[model samples]
Target: MANVVVLLLSSYTSRLATSVLLFISVAHTQNTVVFQPSFLTATGPKTAALLLGNTSDISLYLRTVSPSSETGSIGPPSCVAEVTQWVLTREQVGKSAVRVRLSLDKNLRLCGQNETDADCCPKPLCVLETLQVSACVGGTPQASLLIQATIHALLVPSTAGSDNKTVIPNQVYQTLGSCPCDLTFGACDVRCCCDKDCSTETLKLFASHCLLGPFGGQVSPAPDYQCSVQSAEDSSDWFPFLCVQSPPENNPYLGLFYQGKTIATKRGPSFQRPILSAPLPDNVYLQGSPIFTVNDRYFTIPQKVLGRCVTNAPVAFLKNFEVECVTLLHSCPAGAPLQTLPKDLTVKVKNGQGGDAEVDVIEEVATDLSRFISSTDAVASSDERLACENVTLALDYKFYWKGNSITRISVTRTVGTISLNVALTTRYSAVFLNGEFAGEPNSGNPGYQVGLPVIAGIVDMLENDTGSIQRTSINLWKPVGDGFCSTAEKKPVLFGENSTSGCLLPVSGQNLTQCDLLRETVTSLQAALITATYVAKSGNPDYLTMTDWVNISYVTLNSSTSMDNNTSSCYGIPSHQHIHVWSLITSTVDGIPQRDIRAVQVSYSPSTWALDCGGGDVSSCVDPMETQLFPITSSVTFTDIPINTGPPKTRFQINFTEYDCNRNDVCWPELAFPITKYYTGEPYSQSLAKGLILVFFFVTASILGTPWRQIRQAWSCAAL
Candidate 1:
């Protein structure tokens, strides 16, 4: 399984409003303080607000506490509010007052569940309430303030017509009875679950658990999506498949498109509905009759604990039965498409059982393959191999239909358990293969070979074998555990084993059969791609550039590769890099050169393979070449000795060319390419010539400094 990295994002809201400060005083420089705007009028056009900011680097959070009930019952005393993320340093907000919006959604979830009550939300009571805002910096609350507000009730349709005589509206708690569905539009929550006209049982179920409440939005009337599911003022009616389903691990909250119509379900009270009535997402295909939903005996929704705190945010752990499906037998009404045993599928059956025979067959794989793939705990030598069973299972419902009547007799499938074993071969294979051992140089059919250190050689060759059997050609089913089932990218691969090394699965689930060696090696390459950044100083700009030094070897840049010199390419601040043609194929057929095969080989003999470490008799180190070549490949290439040029030069330096004005329009700053350099300046021959000339001048000056004594005497006589 690939190690997945997940990032979570949090959101907070702020509003701009005028300041309304009450008579209050506090010490300056204190970490805790409150902003202005204290009271809110529900009936007034302008709303009350409290704004906070100005803590330069500290993260500020304001947690709200509702007033106690003794104070004329603070409206919605159970209501609470908080700011999840307020990092004051990043975004600049001046001292001006900024309103902090105080509101909660209809979930009425005080915490994470949906336990509702009068105090669960801010009831529009227009009562004097104390809204206390506590300011915290760096998670420590330094101060708190009480903001007094006169709240007015917002008349919502759900409570607008409630009987005031009975504080608890009977309409708020009513029973839901069976009613016809909005066949054209699908289902209507208001007509059924929240229907004020419904029975007490129905409304109680709706209020307590039904997720379907109301839908209010502009509807585009069209032939395809024309849904006239009755407006709020219309007559009371019920709809099928409108109630909520709560399977322990199955969150039926996510709705789906059923048949042609979309029957969306929510997390609501079951109201004694059958589990088979729950709709599965589109991914799950049912081969049996639609009437199979009537089989309540087998597909029943189990009772679960309730009063779960709900929220608008998706419940990450909320179990979804979206793709879970089961096939059951049912007789369809006449005029149905002829039902016959699915030819593409099969079923296990018990035959010749006198009257009628029925059998069920299924295939289930391991729930979590990673559990069996590896163990950090040491196992006894005898218990090296492990098998995780029931990772995948297939159950088919095969029905034979004569006319409209259907008959499902048999269906069976087996899940083959994948068994993985770890064994220490202790130098199981040789790394070296000379011409003789490889059976003649250039002897194989349309063949190619790369020379490398024994370890690299094995990898490059095994890579070929892995390619020979295309990994993509073989389809691997996504495993069950340690992964998301919806997408393959999120699903766990290779049985949840993060690393495949020292792991081996039995070939075709057979104990005697060993897995393909090449496959095992290939599968182990699941670690993250390692990235390295290299920088090298230039010796001579004209002839030098950085090279890749990995595995203690310098991978040279191709001769034709040139370092970039376009400064304008990066906003007049140019960057450069070294690149080369990297390939691994020797040659091709039909007079074509195969993919370029680039290889570096390090070789040595450990035992009897070659001279055997000064060759005496015979000894071996995993065929001798392995352990010997391994160290050489990893230790030899780093050279303190400079890459020599034709001859030594007097002076040189890596130079950077500036961008001319003409390039400004064509530039875009993208990658921060490394500043690469190559050799530069005068040739060694020119410097040597200049040095010789200087030497000749120095000799001439020395000779001229004192003329020969005879020459001096002759000059004196001539003068006389």
Candidate 2:
């Protein structure tokens, strides 16, 4: 009986243990598993919602629990919650067994007994600890299913920040402050009027005045509001009180709000001004401002667009510029108004009355268009076949200005008529002149400065005209690939640059008369190559004497040589010419340096070579009708004569002394010696003698004042 009783007790104990384990498993499953989302999403700043599985014949309830509450009891009623039936369409409910929707207020209240103790809720105010879903059957209350979770509802602050009264609005005012350029610390900054470090006495002693006034340079004067008021009063139906005030209110709301706890915006890498299609005109133009036009747009000229002419190239104020481009013009019939080069050009000027006025100062220019017509047979025929083509050859603009404002403008156009589809070269140049005092550019005061063109002219020494000298410029070889040389475009030679150029001369004739004409033409062209017989040393010739002029030496071309040669071969064809210029630099007794041209020598190659037909001696003459090509070249070289100017005028010179290491390999010891020396009242030898005497006295006192008896007694004790 005892054994059976023991077995029954053990069995009962095992059964009890099994039941406890099963209960624990069920509770763990309930707490760990949840059908709803883990977090509640915010729909608004203070409103949140959760999505979960839905079921019919079930009612749901929600409650908040403080994370710090250990007893699993409900904390303060911080948030309210509600549930709504969610209906999902077929597409949304595909293979889904549950649908859910629930909402909660994000503005949770804190647990405090009195209003004074109430404070802002924590970051995550309440946690949805448990969701009670009660299932009913046929109107009878049934068992409830508890879905345990640790979901948190975030307390999002409102973007408007209505509760925060001390928050400042995000706004920028254009008020002047202290000088922005005053970077120095604890010291007065030069030209900084608003610098607090600058005292009244120090400011008075400034060498230069402040560029910006007491206010910083960033501030501009407020526009005149009285002008608008007066204009409104002048109107028939307007009143002064009805005009809107220009000043801003003391507490104007900008309607800007913070989106989150921190207020910040992502900045761009670089800053660029906003571009406008047509810029508005301003009363006054600052530095680098675009030039204004009459049509409320920036002034622009036709510039090269992909190697072709296109309009609307903007120009800046106070800038001198020039551009050369090839342009095409549409056919203008015989009697149509010659297409003015610049179709739309009028400048707007400030009239000093708070308004802009248009000025038609651009003078209308007309040129003889017939002079550009091609004389070739093919071009002549093509010109008749097509309509007349008018083109602008050049456009020159002269702007007269007084103190940052343009007062007048002068435009001159050089136009010409040409054949169809012919590319025309157009030159555009602009210059700014001072309206107050307009004067020509000076080469120098008393001596010619470097880089100025040489003052030269031709002397026509004829039997009747002895003193008839015409002012002429140096010529450069310009070839257009027509097998002949041309000087249509003359480019002047500047000083100090040595240059050489050449062109092909075509000699063609059928008989003696044509040959003679060709020879004369060649002779005339060669003679005109170096027509300047004399050149002034300086730009101002009024104070120049006969010695100040430099005469050019060259071989005179005799026109009788070609006539004397009866042969068909052409003679006296100038092959090459060289110009040698010498410069002399000298100084006056007062040490003023001057530059003058010392000598000018012009030499030509031998002109004895004859061009004979049916021979390839100098140049190929394969065809009788074909033109014979002869090469013509010219060169100019400059040489400075070696002359003593004067003594050096430099006031300061520095020399560094170093030990010569190459003279001796053991020079490091000398270099290592210290340079600083200590000086005494007496000489070096006397100071050395005095230092030795002090050293001897100190040694004698240390040697004679010794304790010898104590030392002997200590030694005897050590021996014992």
Candidate 3:
């Protein structure tokens, strides 16, 4: 009978252990198996309460992360709130759970006194009324989780036989699933938590249309916990492209917190280049030369489209721009068609000069360049072919010279029928000498004529092509004939002249544009020159130019005269000027290096005077009668332009620091992509984080293959 009793006791103990193990395992699996809910979401502050179910009784716990004396509830939210971690107490702890009513004093839901401020959340000696508790004890963990459930008081008796003995096993949680979208913690409501508006269909459609996802917090549909979407401005402060900070708002109830990275799209500081570097289509000239309206009164080249991959070019390629004659004319004559200038015709250059050189530095340019440059009729033979008769030939040169001199300077232009030469001569000479290149004593010698070749090509094109001069860049090389040895930086002193006028465009349109207006063409050219000067004078590497464009503003003569360390053979003369000249070229969009264009030409005179000429003639100067120039030209094109895109937007990511329950440390796994709906038709269901953590732990335990039931039975028997 004694042996039988012992065996029966053993069997009973085993059954008891099995029951306990099964119950614990099932509860653990159902409660904390995965730290995440089936569907995870976010909400804004005002609607944060909606994330919770009205029928369910849920309690929240907070543990401060950052050091802040102010303690209060997360209410009256205007933006977003970031918290350290949170814990949850559900109404499911059996009889002990009944004692767990929210402590009004320590709940934090009601305001309390703060250390620095009177209006703060108050603390209590015994804030919690429940006997059974899962407490968070110590230092910060990588991750923590909050689990919730509905409890019924007096469901079961206490497990302790007597005075205050705790016996419940600690539950651990793992993460499972994550949401695809971002959720605002305080902006959600139960009514809209999983509503049609919050459905995946709507989000996907929005993403496709606006190229950005709506805020994550607009999921909850509960009245008090309803969520509202926050605008992009709410994510950060002014200058979103620069600094980032925490959202300025209170925390929302039952919402998510996340940090992460995502793909972004933005406009490049410069333009894009095509892979196939080519030139604009050759003009089909009616005779030997390009077709013109008034027999050289104006010249026009058929507008053409360039491709991508033609990297490293300037914007001056389209310096002399204009509309096709047919596009502007009321009608074309049958036999001898007359091309007319368009009232609103303008000029444009792709990669004016160094556009291609700086191509590699730009992050990304628009691939679909067709949007920037387009033409309706392109077929050459078809009647749809645009007659480029309204083309304008913007001039780029102005010559100046002194009076009463044999050496003359003038501007000569020759297009198809428009060919003329203008001579600029001085009427008087302040300083003059017979036929010698030397000027009079203290007077300035003026010349009969001075030649300016900067705008020579432009004038020629206009004279021969019947083109209009809507815009142009003319350089004036002030040949300071060596005589006045004044050591001073000489910037052009615009007395009675306009420095910003001429063929340059004004600064009014977008990226220097004005509804295809001829006036805009000139203003843009001027703007390009100013841009180039800014770059050269500032000495910023980001603004270095590789190609000289149409508007070659001025060659900065940077001279340095510093004392040298060696003074051995230096007799007494002061310092010598070490001068270097950098040609400043400007395009509509400055700083570009190379580009596709009809033609490119440059003419400049070589240095005429040597510093140490013959025998110590230190005061010698350059002869005003001598001047030379060399000209060169290159043609280019662009082939394939890519497509257009928008800005960048990213979603939040949740990371699991670790799995811990002691001292109520919540281990929340970072949420993955968001889900559309989260209604489980039950209260106390695991959240996305809690569910995932619990699931991980459950799987781990299963993999361990330990006989938990047998272990529990043996332990129970021993205790008995």
lDDT of 3: 0.24
Candidate 2 C-alpha error for residue 676, in Å: 34
lDDT by residue for model 2 over 399-478, one digit each (tens)?
66665566676677665555564444456766767864442333445566667666676555657644444455565555
Superposition error at 213 for model 1 (Å) = 34
lDDT tens per residue, model 3, 1-720: 111100000011101221111111112211121111211111101001111112123233333222225763222211122242223234432321211221122122223334554333234221222111112213212112221221211222335466867654322211121222324454422323222335565545444233122222232222222122212212322232343333324323222322222225455544563244564333222112322222222323233236221211221211322222112222332321122222222222111121211111111222332322223323234443433221222211111213321122112111111111211111111111234332211100110011211111122235455532222222322223331212111222111122211111112212212222422332232222222221111111111132312333332222342323221111112111111122222221211222112222222112211123347542322332222211111111112222233443223322322432222345243133121123343311234446678779988887565777678778999999
**lDDT string, candidate 1, 1-720, tens digits:** 222212111112222234433443323343434444333332221233334333443333434446456884434212234542211212323442233444433222232235446443354443443445444555555434344444344443543564658344222222121132322344344435433355675566545344332221111111211122322212233321242333322422222222345456566678966567544332121222122222211221111124221111121111211122221112221221111223422322212121222433343343543433332334434443454333222232333432232234334432334433421110001111122221111212333222211111111224345311101110122323332212222121111122211111111112112223322322222111111122111111111112211121234324353323221111111011112212333434422333321322222211111122345533332242222210100112211222243555334212311232224443223121121112124433345456678779988877676665567788999999
Best by lDDT: 2
Q: Candidate 1 lDDT (Cα, whole model)?
A: 0.29
Question: What are the clashing pairs of model 2?
Answer: 54-99
Better of 1 and 2 by TM-score: 2
Query: Judged by TM-score, which candidate is best?
Result: 2
**Which ten-residue region of model 2 has the weakest summed lDDT?**
1-10
What's model 1's TM-score? 0.17
